[model samples]
Every structure is written in C-alpha cells, then in structure tokens.
Target: MTLFVAGLSHKNAPVELREQLAVEEDKLRELLSDVSATGAVRETLILSTCNRVEVYGVAEAPGEARAVVFRHLCRYRGVAYGSVEPLLYTHLDGDAVHHAFRVAASLDSMMIGEPQILGQVKDAFGLAQACATVGPALHTLFTAAFAVAKKVRTETEIARHAVSVSFAAVELARKIFAGLGGKAVLLVGAGKMGELAARHLVEHGAFPVYVANRTWPRAQEMARALSGAAVPFAELETALAGVDIVITSTGATEPIVTLAMVQRVMHGRRARPLFFIDIAVPRDVEGSVNTLADVYCYNVDDLKQVVEANIRERLREAQRGEALVMREVAKFLTRQSDVEVIPTIVSLRERLEEIRVGEVRKALARLPGATAETREAIEALSAAIVNKILHAPITKLRESSRAGSSRSWLPLIHELFGLGRK
Candidate 1:
C-alpha cells in the first residue's frame, strides 16, 4: 500500500481559506467516516487546525487516495474545488512520512517551534481512532510521529524561546520589569490570546491576576481558570490603575483603552510604569497612549518584531530538530519496509510446506508395508528438505528490504513462486 498526505496549509492558503475548511471534533468525525466510506483509502486521519487542514491516508494507489481527500475537503466544507485546487499539495510515501514528522515536531507551524500544534495533532489522531478511521498504517505513522516530536523537544532548543505573539508579549513585559515577580496583571478582554499571555505572566510570577470582559460570566469563567479575580467591564479603568501589565485581545472594532482612559488611571499610580500589550486586530489600545510618560504600549505589529527575532533563533535550533526528525523517519520507513515483506515470506513458507506434505503422502501410499516409524522418518525428512529449500530465498527477501531493493524482487518472487499478489 502507498502512504500519502494531501491538504493545504498556511504556507499555501490565506487565513480565510484555512478558516473555511477548519473542522470541529464532531464534524471531523463525520468527515473521517465520509472519506473512508468512499472506499478509496484503507486508512485515514484528518488534522485540522487554524493554520492547516490535511488528510493522511494509506491506499493501494496514492493518486486515487489523494484525489479522494481533496474532493472530500471541498465537498465537506462547501468550497469549490477550483478555489482549493491551486493551494492544495500532496506528498507520497517517504515524503509524506517526512512531512508528518516535521508537523508533529512543530517545525511546520506558522510560528515555528510553538507547542500547541503537537497537542492538536494528538487530538486529531485520537479522534480519528475513535471514528474507526485509523488502522495499522495510520497507527504506526502517528505513534512514530509522536515519538519524533518528543525527541525534537528533548534534543533541541527550538521551543526554548518565545515565538508566538502572546509569549512575545510576556517576554517584553519581563524585559521591561527586569522580572515579573509580584507584579499585578490585568487581562482586559479575556480572549484566547489575552488568556495565554496572562498564563505566561502568571508563570513568570505575576500575581493577583484580574480578568475583565464585556460578558460578566466569561470574565468570571476565565478568572476562575486563571485563579484570579474577575473585574466588571465598568471597572476596567480602575483595574488598569491597579495592575502593572494589561493584555487586551477583544473582538472590538474600535479602541477600548483610549488615551484619556489610561491618562486618568496613570494619575492615581504616581508614575508607576504600566505596559499595555494590545494583541487585538483593530488595535485595542489607542496608539496615542504611548505619548504618556512612564507608560509603554505595544500592538501586534510591534510584537511581530520580537516574534521575528525569536523566530530567527528558533530557526537555528529547528535545523537540529530537522536532522533528528529525518533520522527517525528513516528508521520508521526501514521498519515498515521490513513489515511489508512479511506476507511474501509467509506465502513462500506455506507454498513449500504444501508441496512437502503432498510428496510425503504420495510416498507413504506407494509403500503399503511401511511401518509408523518409517512414515514418521519420511515426514521428518520431507520437512527438513522443505525448510532447506525455503531458507535461502526467505533470507534474501529480507536482505533485499534492508538494501531498499524489495520493489525489484517482490514481484519476481511472487511470479516465480506462483503465489497470488498480496
């Protein structure tokens, strides 16, 4: 069987296209079943994330399996094939294995070396197994991918720096304060990005965290999760005055933290430095807030600079990770090649045994006076001859696999032995 991967990623498609194809777990289950029901692939797994949507499958024909995956992605998401065809990419056999290992190691992330993608991959694998779409092929591939990821984490420094926007924000805060110990932090929006930054801040010893959102319940929920206090939306200005760091990532189109709002809060703090990290798309903090003395403001664009530099360092480390993953991929493929030849070996052994049994039976019939002892001797002699005849061919077949010449000899072996194709 052929192993393959087909999909689009952040490298080939825009966010709008990626978002259109993103699947929730429930939908992903249905999609996995749908793809397998088409009978084009023997095993399948789908990995969907904010940055990519890919299907990994095993089939007798790689081309047909890849085509089926592409068609399914377009049909399931209500997207036109024409729109997606240009952006889609396919990797077959060894290339597919390499891609899977790189992805699991977070080397394929939009922000390389980020940790979230590994967990996302695991979740996808688990969901596919639950849907019964995963079989031996995918099971082997995913489990090896997980091992490669673990090796990358332990062997390289790729994930040691902050490469994400949220983590970069924390790095910036730490730089400004020399350290975040005993500093108060306020999450202005309680969105995913803000929550991640707050988490990092807490990790760095920031205490008495406060979460404020437009919806009171969400604020409370996030506050509870972070082990902090929930502040009312109206009390945002008061929270601002109390905290030394503010991370905002709301869905608002307009600025929520205005110059005047921060200006009012700064007066009560007696020149205490407050850092605002605005990770929102439309700019959560007014740009003019940076004009105020002892107050620092950074938007997403500003953080990208930090992310860029961190990414450069990560790239240096990722080289080492890539080498490790490639080594693991080679080992996995060698094991798979050895496995691929087992059916042929079994067929060969059975064919020899069939001939030996028939010959021994015919000999015993010819000698009506043969005693039980003589018959047993004949049976033993025939079995030894069969084993001797089969030994060299079986050993050669295995050696061919290690030498990467199995494809050259496998078909010949089947034809010569009159064995049906596996």
Candidate 2:
C-alpha cells in the first residue's frame, strides 16, 4: 500500500486554524464517507482533534489521493483550498508510518507524553472502521501503530509526569491553595477536560462541590461518577459561592460564566480567594471575570505554558519513545514491502518453472521411444534443478525480512531477473 498522511497541526497552524478544520465526533462518518466516495484512496482514516487534523490513506496514486483529501477537507470546513494549503504538511510511506506511531504514542502531541492521544487515535480508527472507510491495509497499519504505542508507554516514563492542560490546572490549583486537602472544587461542565480536572482534583484531595452542565442528566451522571452532588444548570451561580476552585469546559458558543455572575457570587463570600481554570476553546468562562477582586483565572493557553515548562522533564523518555517508534517503523515497512516483494518472488519462481517444464518436454520429445520411467525421471530432475536454483535467494529474502533488514535486495533481485516494475 502507498500509505500517506496529509494534515496540519499545532506545530505550524495556530489553534484558530486547527479548530476550523477540526471534525466533530458526530460528523466523522459523513466526512469519512465523502472521503471514500472520491475513489482517490483505497482506504482512509481521519484523525481530527483540538491539536491536529490529519488524514491517512492508502492509494495507488498518493499525490492524487492527497489532493482529494485536501479538497474534501476544504469543502467540508468551508475554506478555500488555497486558504489552508500553506498550513498543511505531507508525509509519505515510511515517514507516514513513523508519524502515525509517534502520534499514537503521544510523542507528537503539544504536551508530549499526554496519554489521551492514544485513546483519541483509537477512537478515530474505530469510527473509520464503523464507517467502512478502513480496509485491510489501514487496519493492519493502525493495529501495529497501537501495539507500538503500548510498547513505548510500558517501557518509557514519558507519561510519568503530569504533562496535560487538565493536570496543569490541578497543579495551578495546588499552587493557589498551597494544597488541596480541604479545597472545594466546582466542575462547571461535564466535558472531557472538566472531568479530567475533576479527577485530578479528587486524586489530590480536593472535593467536588457540585457538578453543573447544560444537561441535568449529564451533570447528575458526572456528579455521581465523581461522588459529588449535581447542581441544576440554572443554579450554577449558587454552587459557585461554596467552592474555592472552579474548572469550566463547555461547548456553548458564548461564555457561560460572566463577570457579573462571578462578581455576584463573590459578594456573598466576603472576598475569599477564587480560582478558575477555563479549558474550553471558546472559553466557557468570561475573560473579564479575571478582573474581579480576589479572583484568578487561567485559560487553555495559560495552562499550556505551565505544561510546557514540565515537558523538558519528559524529553529523555521521549527519546526512548523515538527509538522504539523507529524500530516499529522498520518492522512495519518490512511487512509492507513484502506485500510487493513476496508476489514478485512467486512470479519469478513460476516463470522459471514454466521454462523448466518447456525445456524438459522438448528434451523428452527428442528422445525417441522413451519409457514412462524415463519421462518421470526427466520431470523430477527439472523440478529439483528449479527448486535448488531458487532456494538460496528465497530463504535469504525471508530471513532478512525477519531481521528487519535487506529490503533493498528487492529492487536488485527484480532487475537481475528482468522482472517488470511492481
């Protein structure tokens, strides 16, 4: 398979551009179906997240396949192809394989060693499978990447330190209170980031004051899961007064917690210190809320800066991950190369067998009145000669493949035998 990946990420594009191309969970099937509908790629998978929007595919014409991907992405996101083309990065074949492995292991994440990327990659692969966009080649590629990611995780300490924005929120909370032994936390939304923050808080001894969400049932579910009481959506302001730490991540288009709301909540508390971590992209909490007296607010970018300082602590572990991914890429490439190599060898053997049989028949025909035993003997000799001639090279090819080396022998042997291009 001519595997390729074309996409943009936080490395080149800003969050605003990335979010423009971000594919929501609900629209994945439709987008994947559109990608598959183009007939440019034989197999496809889309990995769209807050940090990156990448498309992986296996196609005969990789250049054309990539163009189709860009076209579909631009059309779906309602941007001109020219608008986003400059932000895109393309990886082909071995690079594509290595990139996938690195991404699955979280080595490519904004927060290196953040574990959530592995689950997110799995989710993308799963949704692709459900949409019937992923076939055998992609399935094998993804499965191998997943295994490599697991191996890297278990062997390295890349994830030993807290490196995510949510964890950074927890760290900030600790710094504010000096400790969270008895701090009250209000999770203003049940989004993944908020849930993660809530878990980290609980793990650090902060108790959830109340879980609030746009939906009451979801709030109830998250509250129950975190061992906290659910607060009705309308009464989030009332719940705000009791907590010292607040983490909010919601999907609302506008801010859900206004400056006025926080100010009113603060009036009742007699100037007690309040901390808010707004992890949502559009920001569930208003920016002006930070201006209120005795209140401190941090957004995603703020938490990222804190996480960035801690990334150096995991760089050594990331080096180990890079080495592991390199080895896996070699193995994956060896397997992929054999998809063509094995068939070429088989074709060469068959071609040789055809020549051997034709020569044997001519030789037998020249022998007048030959017995059946003589004919059988001639056939046996021809078979033995063909097998002996091919055995050494065939065995060497298979053995070298197992050792993750000598794949270059493929083109050499192809040329030596006058085999046509694969």
For each candidate, how many residue pairs have backbone atoms clashing (under 3 Å)?
A: 0, 0
123: Cα error in model 2, Å: 1.5
Query: How far off is residue 151 in model 1, in Å?
Result: 0.9
Encode model 2's per-residue lDDT on 1-422: one tens digit a residue. 48899898889989988888887877878888887888989999999999999999999888788778878877888978897887888898789999999999999988788888999999999999999999988898899999999999999988876677888788777777978988998888788878888888999999756788888999999999999988888988888989999888888889988999998999999988899999888998888888888899999988888877767768888998999899989988878766645886797898788899899989988998999999999999999999998998887777665554545777777777777774
Alpha-carbon lDDT, every model: 0.90, 0.86
| Candidate number with greatest lDDT | 1
Best by TM-score: 1
- Once model 2 is optimally superposed onto the true structure by TM-score, how far is the C-alpha of residue 144 displaced, in angstroms? 1.0
Instruction: Give per-residue CA lDDT, model 1, range 1-422, as digits (tens).
Output: 88899899999899999999898998888888988999999999999999999989998887787777777777888989889888889898889999999999999998778899999999999999999989998999999999999899988989877867888888888778979999999998877888888999999999989999999999999999999999999988888988999989999999999999989999999999999999899999999999999899999999998888888889999999999988998899889988989999998998888888888889999999999999999999999888888888888998899887898899989999999864
Could you tell me the TM-score of candidate 2? Answer: 0.58
